[model samples]
Target chain A: MNLTILIVMAVLTGVLGSPYVTDTDVTPGSDSAGMSAHPNSVPEAADGTEVFHEEGVVEEEGVEEDVMATGELNPSHYPAQRAANVVKHYLNTRYGSPYRWVGLHKVHSANAEEVAESGRKYHLEISVQEMTGNTTEKCSAEVLFPALENQRSPQVQASCEALLTANTTAQEEALYQQYRRNHTLLSGHNLPDSYGHIDPDMKPLWHLGGVASSFVMLKESTENTLYNMAQVANVTQLETENDQLRFNYHVLLHDMVSQEIIHWKLLVTWSPAEGVKVLQMEELPKCEHCEVPPKPN
Target chain B: MKALLILIVLMNLDKNKCFAFLSFSDQVLSITAKTQEQVELLKNVSTQYETVLWQPVSPEYIKEEEPVHLSPSAFAQSFASRFCFRVLLDNTNEMIELQTRNDSTDPRSSSSYYERYHSLEDIYYWINRTTQEHPEMVKVVLIGSSYEKRPLYALKISVGEKQDKKAIWIDCGIHAREWISPAFCMWFSLSYYNQNQDITHILNHMDVYVLPVMNPDGYKYTWTTNRMWRKNRSYSTDSSCVGVDLNRNFDANWCTEGASDKPCSEIYCGAFPESEPESEAVANFLRSHKDSVQLYLTIHSYSQMLLFPYSCTLDEAENHNELLVMAQEAAQKIRRYYRNTYKYGAGGKTIYLAPGGSDDWAYNLGIKYSFTFELQDRGRYGFLLPPSHISKACNEALIAVKTIALRVIEKTQAPQ
Candidate 1:
């Protein structure tokens, strides 16, 4: 009876051990003993957070460790360094092609001391150089990356989505300023002419149309004497809603022939699809009869 | 393990492929970036999104609202509004197709010098044929080979005895996509060959050297691969980007203000002055014949402006008054004949500061009569000016060239 039991136990052990050996043989690089056969099949926690490994590599056993270590110290302690790394990697991945000349000149942490205790955000200033023939031209960019506390790694994998440069702010300001200025100038605002201030190509339409009907009629009656002077003023209000920049401006228009000044309120909207345009230009009723003031000079 | 291996292979494949999907059907936009901020925005967008800048002006000179051509994608369309640029060309591809169709038609269609934009092969054939047909008037000279080993041909049009005659060097298509420029060169050559009363007078006094296509490799590339390639096909050592802007690759103030250092940029000044074979060859020829080459006329397109040095700086050239007067005369002649307006002024002030231009370099080399003719409708069509408009553009350019040549002859005669 003891011999029969020993043989039976050996057979059962062999049957189970044979399958494990075959699985390991079939999948060479996978850590089958640690977890699942599929290396990329990551497991999630109860709260749907990705559990990461200590080394930041997504290993199979990392799922259980991440879930258990949720209450422990956070892995991404240095947010600034992480953000800088993210941007650097992104630049290399995007521009480091055989056909492109963009090279990373320098990558340094910007506003490191400004990092919040929560370690949720970081900023980095990066300078990139493009090698054209024998010359190297340099341009700098500012990157702002936001970190999610529950992310698998300290570096946001999608920080490229938040890549910001000097252009971002400049682009936004230009749209707002142009809309406001166009609104002011078109609504009969005679703004001062300084170099680079007014559009050189701006031409006033002589045809009677829309809100300019009255102005056109008046201009035709005093065609020779009445010279219409239009100028754009500072944008009083600017907002971006639904991917469009809306602007409000105080416009001034002077009629030299009539010796009258017109104060107008204008609204302008700009978008990539529609381009910079005046949504509405209304001649404010209050300033219709305002007399032109003489210059101090 | 298999999945990991497959992913690595896919990544490698992605690296080899062009990130920007530039196709023949893609739309090109001409937008004005007016402010310093707008210029920066455009430059940033160009680098990040890989948009090909068609304008010859570098990113630094984009201040005060310079018109730029951008081949837009979904990515570029997103930033158009934020930059506050007005759209100049809504569908550049449409016009390109129209121009291409016009160019592909047989050269035998019309007999007035040139009817349409011709290919490099056709232009060469025409050059050879012109030399053969009018052996007494025209002779083809091979100056140098391009980066791709394409021969650079210059037609010597001398009707009178070659002894002691001053020469005028006229080169066009420095920027490859300026099809009108090369067209103008061919037209000027043929028109001068016909020996009209004024042309005969000018030719008798001076020998005209016409190089229709300056950058042959870039011109061929524009015809075959990309229609908007602007630089010579010289590889950059420090960067992977190809080609050098031959106009900006001259030794004078090279790679300075208004010239780019980015290899992929349109206005990329080469690694060194005369780094490109095309520019180097032209430079060598000009230097060798600097004494006899009395006038240097480099033709460019789109902007209706006649410019003279000094383009590298705001400082006026020694012969500023003479140059200004001659350019004004040329512009006035063009206006009188063609009913078109051509702005005539110093290069740096009239158009933004563009260093290393051939005209500027030649002027610095003592060729006081160097003038750059920016031909045709300011921005109505940009580089994609239709073949139908070629006749009108070439006609206007001919008047200007004739005017400048006549002035050079008169000046030389006055001194004699």
Candidate 2:
């Protein structure tokens, strides 16, 4: 190496190992799609203090585990839908997201196994969709329902690969607190407005509504149905409860597969700590031609 | 003389000093610049500590109230409290170490050298040798030469002797430090030449145009001198920075917010668009073949993302939804096969608003399916991704490439 290159490398090495200075094309943008053009930018949250190194060689799982083949069970049944419901909660806790908020779109097949005195395990093949964006992915998840159901949360291992969640906890937390502090929590109707545009600040509210609606869609969802939160017919802010903000929403759910617009009402509460919780959901009477969004209050 | 003595001192410093030191706390910290003085102070601190910044890459990127993030892995607290800095993360060294711990590569390994990281010379040799070996399948075309007068070689790979097939154009290693990008191109070429039937099926549909190393001069510089050079070996009358960020040298929304115009800056966009020979060559080649090339894929590394236009602005692409779904499907394939996560969406929304990028330029030129892939190990090993990951990273990228190529074919070349 030339003296200049060696000296530059040496100074950088001493400064912060090879992970130093401007020059090397390194992307420590653990969360953001940070522009690489900027030198000296490391990841935001990945502190320099210490990290646990999982020392496994880059080797593929050579043997593919074949799931025992079984007949496809009806997705609308209580047992099947209950297990799928567990998957939805599991996903929310892992994500608790706004953009890449994924919910169970459909349960294609379900196989139930009863464990003596332990629990009932459900092996499921399902589809998960990004609630905000209209992309759905096929996922294989295994959910275990312990015999003592109320006492323990179901353990779930899901292969829901196509999820695009942003690491904006700081922003989300700030937004949540900002909303809580306000006497008027963002309540609106026909968001994306008449012009098909949602103000950037109001996007999180709609995203939350979509996430809350996921619970209803997940419950009513079957192998034949595809659902999306089309529009917020009306949304109203309710009182806060124990640091969680509650809201009442009248929303339209569009079934893409069937091209039908349905109306539903939901009671929801959310906090950064408690994620999104759907307290209640009630389907409204069939309203024909409800695609014409209700006028904003 | 001072530089030489400084070099000597740096050379003598114990490598284990990083481990032995207890006073230092490696942390990702933020410094909010209330004034230009504070911004200048931050720039100085960044230089002194060699901190890797996290957000608002440059002080210029810092908005009115937005704070910038930096990983001062070598800085301790109680120093420079004037800036109101907060610790974002600690233990980045251990993380990076853990990430690279599995990096095992031996040049002496398997005689089949196609699966290894090669020098610029070796890459050139491979291009020649492969062209000779697979005369029927591969034909080497000299796109243009680098600023250092190195020939930029592109291979047109097609199964049968069909000159006018709808094609897929791929260019790799545009940024020299991103070694994995070039490695992908090499792996892709080797796989096709190896009679990988699945790859051949795609070739049967679209003639594959592969530029193995887009910036040869900078790549050679990385191998020989500094391993972090991200630009071409070009010169300008104004400054002595010695190179221009070729990716930023494209004409689309040239040198906007995400890019820097100062020649010394890494993202300096060149005197104008196509100021450097490397970028000029690529632009010319893509422009001439814009009609035939249905998909233009540019490979990059470290941030495992499948990005499409337009990175230049916050505005969505005309076919943004189509591109998003394609990228999503490609990402899913990587996840299912490799068990790794890859973010897929519009470049602007998915990553950040990066102007003058090649993908955006290519897309604007009417290559509807243009994409730029940032490959492998999210941030663990970054640019220095190690030889052991060569096969896995390349394979992961290959999966994404094939998925998108098949999708384009299904959309475009359907039988009547």
Candidate 3:
């Protein structure tokens, strides 16, 4: 932790000069001469949130030049957008893998504030997309841009565990054991068998496909793309390497915006304790009769 | 008409005490904090004009360009400058008025009847009146009473004499502030006879149990005290904070991530699973009917998603594929018909990993086909889905309900 910390408080509209805004503010404070406060105020802990009063570095009163905030920010605007952009980098740094590309799908909310000594800090609640897995999470994070003198990767504080998991090795192990016991190298032509239905036994592979593809998606995605795992075109389980089970998968990526079904082949490895790791990705030549969604998002 | 007048007077008498004296934020605005200069400018405005943030819950959460909705004091409007403020609500007081509005209308006008958001008193009246009108199909089953002693009414919808048949259990308004959820339940019941083929077909093979307003105490609190109130109105004797998140009071991985153990936390799991009477009532009902109930569905709002079991863990449900397809079909049906997109997947994988969810609990209880549907307006309107959008939202939900229920029937009742 740095000795001098920065605090960016968004939505402190009436308490700009004040060091803090508490529940007491909801009542028309005596300081407010004419304005009336909200009478039907939310009781403490009633609104699915804990008051953002953290036990962090609290500075002295009267740092007049220290704070900056506007309650909400435009998603398209630079400050908020850049904050969202940093989260993409943060996820890649934390959960990045081969064959997976991650990016910000949408910004639910973004706001920025500049504090003294350090730099500007942004509090953002955003949805992150793991492109290959076709999975998304609405994650709330804090990103701080340091002062010019203390330049570094934008300091990020986000708990995006949905895209990354380390504790589920038990489930992975059990599945791996079951797969190994089958003796023959598992291989399948299509995940859903073309009936838009995955066989009971084949469901786990489909899920792992999504998980492995997330790495590629995370690597290649951006603010503009909305990707979906259209199918596991074909997958063949390779011989076990040490402890991990390796598989070669060809999957279809449907770009919802362009309504194009793109094909790619992935070299993925999985083990119960360790997790799905994409070894490589290769984009195959486009097929002429690739099906298109009637209405793509 | 005379009875309706008395109900109105009673609702007013109830509201005029403590609640009527409440003051509300006149206008709510979604504003942008684009730069340091803009943040300073907003700080100056708040210090000068006194606007309060409606979203983000507190000022500490504000960041550059993080979408924060501000309930700027009417006083701030004249002097507010520099920030590009997008108006979200002119006056939340007006919205609150409609939510608690009690008006007499001809039941024949289905539009007027189903469109308005009803008060606790209004919903009870509707349940009684509807049961009387449709004596053959609808029967009110009192599952249990809330902490405040309000009877939890579950409407059992069947076509004829109830015989041993498969059942589907759906409980709504579990979180209280989710008024749209209870509204969907009412809409679902009414449409059972709306010349709706899907509802009729499901009722042929399965009896539907619809519990509207599961958390009556919390639901009533939102009307009388806090509009954004979630959780039930129950209190732990040791803690000052009132209420347990009923959704998180189930037995499946109780008090895990996305849930809190502290009594004051919003998603606080009760002292133990099934601790809250609301969750206990629903759990007991499902347990007793575990053999016959083929499916379970719970309703919530704001984010449009069809979620199935295993919200407690990252691991896939034993029937993950089956549940996912059912939810997918439901979402696709809504999209194809109403043109609204809905994300569908495992509750843990699709959204956040919220433990102690009813859907997961029900699935663990052997009800393989379980779901939680979050309905309407991704984040734009959120829980305060307006009355104008009520019909469309309800119809979209109805499509999903029918699609899933029909699918369950096919899978369970197919010629063996």
By lDDT, the best candidate is 2
lDDT of each: 0.53, 0.64, 0.63
RMSD of each: 33.7, 23.0, 26.4
lDDT of 1 at B154: 94
DockQ-based CAPRI category assigned to the predicted complex of candidate 2:
incorrect
When summed lDDT is taken over every stretch of 10 residues in candidate 1 chain A, the lowest stretch is: A15-24
Tens digits of per-residue lDDT, candidate 3, A172-234, equal 567778887778899875554321234557767766675666555545544233445556768
Q: What is the lDDT of residue A14 in candidate 1?
A: 14
TM-score of 1: 0.46
The CAPRI class of candidate 1 is: incorrect
Question: C-alpha displacement of B97 in model 3, angstroms?
Answer: 24
Writing each residue's lDDT as its tens digit, candidate 2 over B1-416 gives 33345334433432211111212223344456778777776766665654555565454565434566665533433344565554333223323322222234443443124445778887888789888988988899999999999999999988886668899999999988788888889878866753332465688889999999999998987676545567888888987667888988999999887777887666778899988888989999998998899999999875567888988986878998888789888876665545555656666654455788899999999999999998865322345554545655676688788889889998998773
Top-down DockQ ranking:
2, 3, 1
Those runs of model 2 whose alpha carbons end farther than 4 Å from true positions after fitting are A1-297, B1-112
Reported per model, the fraction of native interface contacts reproduced equals 0.00, 0.02, 0.00
How big is the positional error of residue B220 in model 3, measured in Å on the Cα after superposition? 0.4
* Window of ten residues with lowest summed lDDT in model 3 chain B: B14-23
